[model samples]
Target: MSISERISALVGPASFVVAGGLSVAVAIFAAITIERRTIEDVETVLAADGIDWVLVSANGLQVFLDGTAPNEVARFRAQTGASAIIDPDRVINRLDVAAADTAAPPRFSLDLLRNGDGIQLIGLIPGPGGDEAFAIAEAIADIAGEAEVVNMIESAELAAPETWDAALAYGLRALETLPRSKVTVFADRVEVEAVGETREQRAEFIAQLQQDQPEGVEVVLDISAPRPVITPFTLRFVRDAEGGRFETCTADTAPARDRIVAAGLAAGATGVIPCTIGLGVPSPSWGEAVETALEALARLGQGTVTFSDADVTLIAAQGTAQVDFDTVVGELDADLPDVFSLQAILPEPETLASTGPARFTATFDAEDGARLRGRLPPGSIGQSVQTYASALFGADATDIATREVADLPQGWSVRVMAGLTALSELNDGQLVVEPDLLRLTGNTGDTELVSRLTRLLTEELGPGENYDLDVRYVEALDPVASQPTPEQCESRIRAIQEETKITFDPGSTEINDTAGEVLDAIAEVLPDCLHVRMEIGGHTDAQGGEGMNLNLSQRRADAVLNGLLARGVLVTNLTAQGYGESQPIASNDDEDGREQNRRIEFRLLASAEVAAAAGDIDDQPRTRGGILAQGEIADWPFEIRPLPRPINPDGE
Candidate 1:
């Protein structure tokens, strides 16, 4: 082809090539657009069904699901369902439904006021369904794109009571008020505005209102009137000091008030305040008088005078005169010669009764009178002598003495006889006359008579040189004999056994049946007593280990205790003790000796009454032989043979 023809032809072929390229480009664009549209449609459908997904890729009319659906089955159904509208071969299921679900944004519902990007929710969720609100909000944000949530869901709380009774019973207590008939409650802003009389009633209303308020709600009380004051009580007594007619004081204050006034001071108090003086009756002067008389009697080396009821009355008599001429005359006879005379002119009975005074005149022979006058001092004459005589004759006077005369011995003898007669008269016809017997015999120069009289008098009188001469009396002692009653014998046996450390068998633990026979004998003798406490002790020898022996002893003791219990002995009254090698009555060196040492002892634990019933028998044996001697055993009226050992091992 020529240059021009060639250029045109090349242009034509180039144009055709360019057109084919344009067509191919347009077709590819249309396919891409269709796939994209299909994916958008599938997503829309999923969104309406509360499902979410992602468009992974699009190949011609085919589509792939990349995001999660509500469930695995739902995801498969979504993919397959989308393929039905598109092409399955182009759809790649590389999406992990579980992973996608974990990564997916939560769905929510929003009944909100959205201004641009802000959201404000308002609605009741019923029954504290706050979790539902959060879920709905999140879901709405996920579906409609992210947004801010101004959550206004309230916490669940109980409804408030509208009535007073229901409110009062709602766990709220009034300060110091009880619910009453007229109480009422009105709640405003979770507060009580009370309108009522009676402070207690108002308080109840306020409390009931407060009771109905929810937590975090402020309560305000608007009471119309002031609450009544609860005043404390004052204990008032009816007293003159309080301008009352009746006089009164605290009962306990009487003692202190009286004490203050009794100290010789006017207590500062008004009204009739009763007084109690603690002054007691004076001690008897009779005790001092008796003590003085006892001292005087002691000085006289005579028998003591004990004042009985009868003696006290007689001595205390106001106008009574006691003619103690025996004491007076005995004193005179002791000081004077063998012969003396006493002219006792006691005051007349009527005069003594009126004046309560005593007068006595003792006369002596001329020589005796001279001796008496010589013994008197120069100023002791007439009135002085008479005063001395009056003192000797006074009611309180016990004795008197006069000098004896050596000259005119015959008159002295006569005076001595008169003194004896006077002594007999004062003695109330009960004079001992022992000293007189000695004096008379001494003057006669009869050694035998003096000795005999002295011995006789000393034997009859006690360790005294004088006698009371009040009256002669003889007393015969009546011995008390107590026979053993059954109760008494039982008590004695129990006491003896307890004190003596007596006991019974070990392992076999029972009191020997023979012991029962002994007890039966005792019971036969004495029958009234009933209750008894017996202590059975088990002792072991030193042949075994101390711990083992101790346990063995205890078991043995328990065995005996059980035996006693089986025998109808009260469990409370029976006590068992284990003394492992502690108490040994015999040597523990040899087998036989050890056997003897391993023994049980029964002891009677007697009470005081039972011990008292044991009588006067000496519980201690005279000697060790007495305890071990066969004669002593034979002397027991009842024979006690040893009980037979049980045959079977378990019978114990």
Candidate 2:
């Protein structure tokens, strides 16, 4: 064979071999590039979808997702998200879901007691430390005049129930307001048992409590008023020139009280006269004697009649006919029960000078205590009066300055003692006494003080006597008026929102059922806050069109307003506004940020004038139906039209 022919054959075969090696290298490089691009794309897609926990990598055509997912749904979500960037057949999910949490939340409870001694708190609280307990102690100290707090509260390092904080807060507030109370607080309810000074005060306390109640927590209030015990069981009726009035009235039973009251009314005693039914009664026939005496006074046409225990006294008025007085007194004395004794007097009319009929005055005040500058009868009567005054008005509180009078009156000692007793009932007032007239004028925190004084004075002075009363009720001194203000109510609502949000369904304006408690808590507080102008602001994330977001937010705000209305909150002071994508508390790029942006916020609006001037307030209807109508155009997918009204033929 020739040399050239052999070289050419070897060259051709080597070239073919080199070409095959290059082809194999090119194919390998292309495979590596495709795998790298696939991995990058899958990872980018997973991160954007918030599936970063499921890590992405690729082997040739196959992409592997390997990491611990939060749950089965999360794992599936990560796989599906990754598949969207590539092919589902080429993706392998090696993700394991984390185990479900099994630890139980701790039960929270509180017991608060407030009395003359001070305040006591015993409870269980959930926390990472004892800060919550410390806050409670500090709050109690501030509210109760540095009152001693026996905080036996224990702190547990566990998750708290949803309503624990709110219930505890309400219980503490109750303890602060009520002077003598026992409050029990659980995660979901609060029970209050308190003593009020009057029936009106009890009602006021209930109203205040119900107004400031937290959402979802139940408030049970059992308030009571202290009943005054009548010492002498007295009744008095007088039919003088000023018409008939009961200076004081008392009965042992309801039936007895009704009978006595009826007799007073029949005798022309004006308005609703309160007859105190107390522990002491002189006799079972006390009502009978009182009725007979009142009827006798009414028939006599001019006189005063008084009943003190079993003793009955009838004094005929000046100018009453002597013959008429004798007949009435004779009948009353004869008709009286055996337990009762009668004193009948037809006083002789006397010409008096301008000194007001030998007047004596006593004064009682919260700031100055009690002072007596009154005339007393001769002998030990003066000393006895001083001693009696000291006992009834407290020794430290009483100061007596009196002059002895030989001829004071027939029942002068009785009148002095009765005046002092009546004076003691006033928080601040004065008592005036004369031979024939008794007068009391003052202001009291007690709503029933006038009735009580009347009962005491009537029995002491006898039925046909005359007396005047001028008492006023002061709310500042009233314990029942210690209620949370509008500012405090707003602060409480803000605190509640901080702990837990009023959440809604995903991508919808409908409130979530889990938000029931939150809504309830807010509803309870709204009545007190009604005096305060407020705005319910609805906000949204930057996930949708600006118009759609605006409309959605407005609807959500309306929904909250409706929720409060359903819970019996008056909406006159409330307005709803939608900020939409305009107000972003956090960046809208992340799930948590978006979540924070999508919220229902309660804001105290400026005065109507200010809000209107600033143009922050929108022109929308306040009613539920009208508000719903405002959103109809934005919420509905189709166009809305108003129905045309039918026209009459003659335009009548």
Candidate 2: residue 644 Cα off by (Å):
59
Superposed model 2: Cα runs more than 4 Å off: 1-229, 352-357, 362-421, 424-428, 435-438, 455-652
Question: Candidate 1 residues 1-652, lDDT tens each?
Answer: 7999989989998999999999999999998888778777777765665565555566665566776555678777776666665557767775555644454322211123444454455543322345334433443343223546575744233332233212221111121122111222222122233345664456435533443243332445564434332111000111112221101111113343344223212212344433322122122222232233323233332222222211210111112234453453344334432222222222233443443211122432212221122122223333354354444334233233433223322222323233233332221221212211212210222112222232233233321222222112112211111233323544565564444332455444455765445434433422222223444566788875665665667667776556545555445644565556656777888888887777655544322112212221122112211211211111110111111111221222
Highest TM-score: which candidate? Answer: 2
Score every model by TM-score.
Answer: 0.19, 0.40
Model 1 stretches with alpha carbons more than 4 Å out: 1-287, 292-312, 315-507, 515-536, 541-549, 555-575, 581-590, 601-652
Best by lDDT: 2
The clash numbers for all candidates, in the given order, read 21, 17
lDDT of each: 0.37, 0.73
The TM-score that candidate 2 achieves is 0.40
Q: What digit string (tens of lDDT, one per residue) describes model 2 on residues 302-340?
A: 777767778787877777899899898899899987899
Tell me the lDDT of model 2 at 460. 60
